[model samples]
Target: MTEVGILGTGAQVPDRVVSNDEAGAAAGVDDAWVVRKTAIRERRWAAPEQATSDLAAAAGSAALRSAGITPDQLSVIVVATSTPDRPQPPTAAYVQQLLGAVGAAAFDVNAVCSGEVFALAAAEGILTRRGGHALVIGADVYSRILNPADRRTVVLFGDGAGAMVLGPGRGARVRNLALHTFGELAGLIEVPAGGSRRPADQAALDAGLQYFTMDGRAVRSFVEDRLPLLTKQFLHDSGVGPDDIRHFVPHQANGVMLDALFAELALNRAVMHRTLTHYGNTGAASIPITLAEAARSGAFRPGDLILLAGFGGGMAVGFALVEW
Candidate 1:
């Protein structure tokens, strides 16, 4: 079997900063109330002209530069996002054009917040089979899909993108990658219209069904009930102990959820890297964005063990174990 590992990582957030005070005011709440609930102080939102592919291209370019490779060298480009520029063209295709990655196979995957992990797994498999470089990006522009007046959803999302360049290497080998989805819980977080199941008609638009909606409490309960079981089984099957993990990178869902997971798993807070307080939740971009931030800050070192886990809207969950 071919060994695939990450060659480089990069992240990019928009320049527009939306502070908690501003968001809270827009949602008819106080800043303190928002902070107390989500622990998010601020987040970035893309400019009017910027789209998800724009962010993905920027991050992917940075990752290519960091990896000391050019776009033309890429064999594949996989983008994970729910927010595409248009419904017709895959976001990755736009990213590929923006990056000038000629001849690279490009596509998009939508697993909501768990998207990055899913993309990583896909890229790893591609490299193993084709023995070439793959650029994987996780990006989201939730600001466009969110209902500004809905504090429950609006306060928890931001726009950003993160990317990784992977190839056959030995820097940080991907040990285990697993993904699962529960469609029954899919309605817990979703856009009620604009899809095949519910086409975007004028009635849907008038009803505000195009906006994102989530059952915060139900989602929390789902995570609380499922995370422990999944983590336990993943660790057991991978023969990795909680103590062996030097870094724990999870989807930046929220601070409260992280706290609950930490307590339930009995993991050290020092080993967990969090970016939510500053970035809120960037949906699919969260994991790679957090990982890149941590990596740049020297939070990871050679020979350290890292565990990446994420759960999201499809009621999907994904895990990846690596030895750095």
Candidate 2:
């Protein structure tokens, strides 16, 4: 088996800062309390004109640069996002163009917040055949669709992007990947009326269902039970125990979600590095965003055990065990 370890990672947060207070004023939350609950002082909001592909391109460029490879070297480009620049053209196409990935085939994947790991799994499937290298990018600008007045979604999300390059392998790659979804809970955190379920129009807008909504209490309960349970399940399935793993890179859902997960895993907060406070939840971009920052900070070493996990809409969840 080729050792398909991660070659490099890159991420980009937006330029403007939306402080918790500012977000609170806009979203109707207690500013100080929001900070304490989520450990988010502020978050990056993309420029009004910025598109999801733009962010993905920035991250992809950085990832290719770090890997010392040109875009032409890649065989595939997988972009994961729910909020794409356009409803039709796959967002990855634009990113490939920006990265000069003229020869690489590109497309998009959508699993909401679980997008990064989902796309990575797709990348692994292609490389497992011993044929190619790939660029997996996750970028989202939920703020664009968000109703600025909606407190639930607005404050918990921001714009950002992250990417990683998957090289040809018979290598020690992602050893195991598992996924689960329960569409029954699809109503928990979702943007109703946007798609076929209830097509958006002047009527849906008047009904106030055009914006995203979350049954916050229900999602908290869902995360509380699943996060810790799945982490342990993944460790066991991979034949790895808590002590055997060097790092836990989880989806940056929110600080509240992290606080619950860390406690359940009986893991110290220090053992699991986080970047949610700085960028908020970039949906599928969260995990890789943190991974890119950690790599640059020298937080990882060769031969380290890495666990990448994510969960979000489609009521989906996924995990990947890799040797870094």
Candidate 3:
């Protein structure tokens, strides 16, 4: 089997910074409440003209540059996102065009916040057979779908993108990957309208069904229950252990949840990487964004074991073990 690995990583966020005060004002809360609940001090909001594709393209370009690979060398471009530019065309199409990756096959993956790892697994498989580089980007513009008055979600999400270039190289070698989904719990986090089942109409609009909604308590319970078990199983199946991991880069869902998870996982030697303090939960962008920041800062040592985990809507969870 061909050995594929991450060649580079990049991240991009909108210039507009939305402080907790700003996010909470309309949500009937205050900065203190938000910080206490989510540990989010601020987040980035996309400009009116920015969309998911734009951010994905920018991040992809950076990844390509860091990898020293030109756009035309890309064999595939996978964009993992839920808040796409439109309901029809795959957002990867726009990203491909913007990046001038004309020959690369492009598509989108909608595993909600778990999309990045899903996309990474997909790209890794393709590259193993196709023998070329792939750009995997996770981007979202949650600010567009959020309900201003919904304190549970509005204060927990932001707009941003993160990306990685994968190919046969000497970077972080992917050791194993795992993904899971609980379809029955899909309703725990979703936009109730605008899809085939619930069309966006006047009634749905009036009911505010188009906005993002989540059973926050239930979702938290799910994570608290499943994450540790899954992490242990994943490590065991991969012939590793929690203590073997040097770094844990998980989805920037919530700081409080992550803190608890970190403690429970007992990866005592591992340093948990988090960007949610300022970026909030940027949908699928969180993991890669956090990973990119750490990589750029010279955080990882050669041959270090790194774990990437993401869990979110679709009630899905994805994990990837990497040798950095």
TM-scores of the candidates are: 0.98, 0.94, 0.99
Candidates in descending lDDT order: 3, 1, 2
lDDT of 2 by residue, 7-116 (tens): 77889888998888787776678668777677777789999879999999999989888776788889899999999897788999888888888788899999999999
Tens digit per residue, CA lDDT, model 3, 1-324: 679999999999999999999998887999999999999999999999999999999999989888899999998999999999999799999999999998999999999999999999999999888789899999999999999999999999999999999999688899999999999999999999998999999999999999999999999999999999999999999999888999999999999999999999999999999899999999999999999999999999999999999999999999999999
Poorly placed runs, candidate 1 (over 4 Å): none
Cα-based lDDT for every prediction: 0.90, 0.83, 0.95
lDDT of 1 by residue, 37-87 (tens): 988889999999999999999999888887888999999999999988888
Candidate maximizing TM-score: 3
Kindly report which residue stretches of model 2 are placed more than 4 angstroms away from their true locations once superposed: 1-3, 169-172, 268-270
Q: Rank the candidates by TM-score, best first.
A: 3, 1, 2
Highest lDDT against the true fold, candidate: 3
Root-mean-square deviation of candidate 1: 1.0
Q: Scored by Cα lDDT, where does model 3 land?
A: 0.95
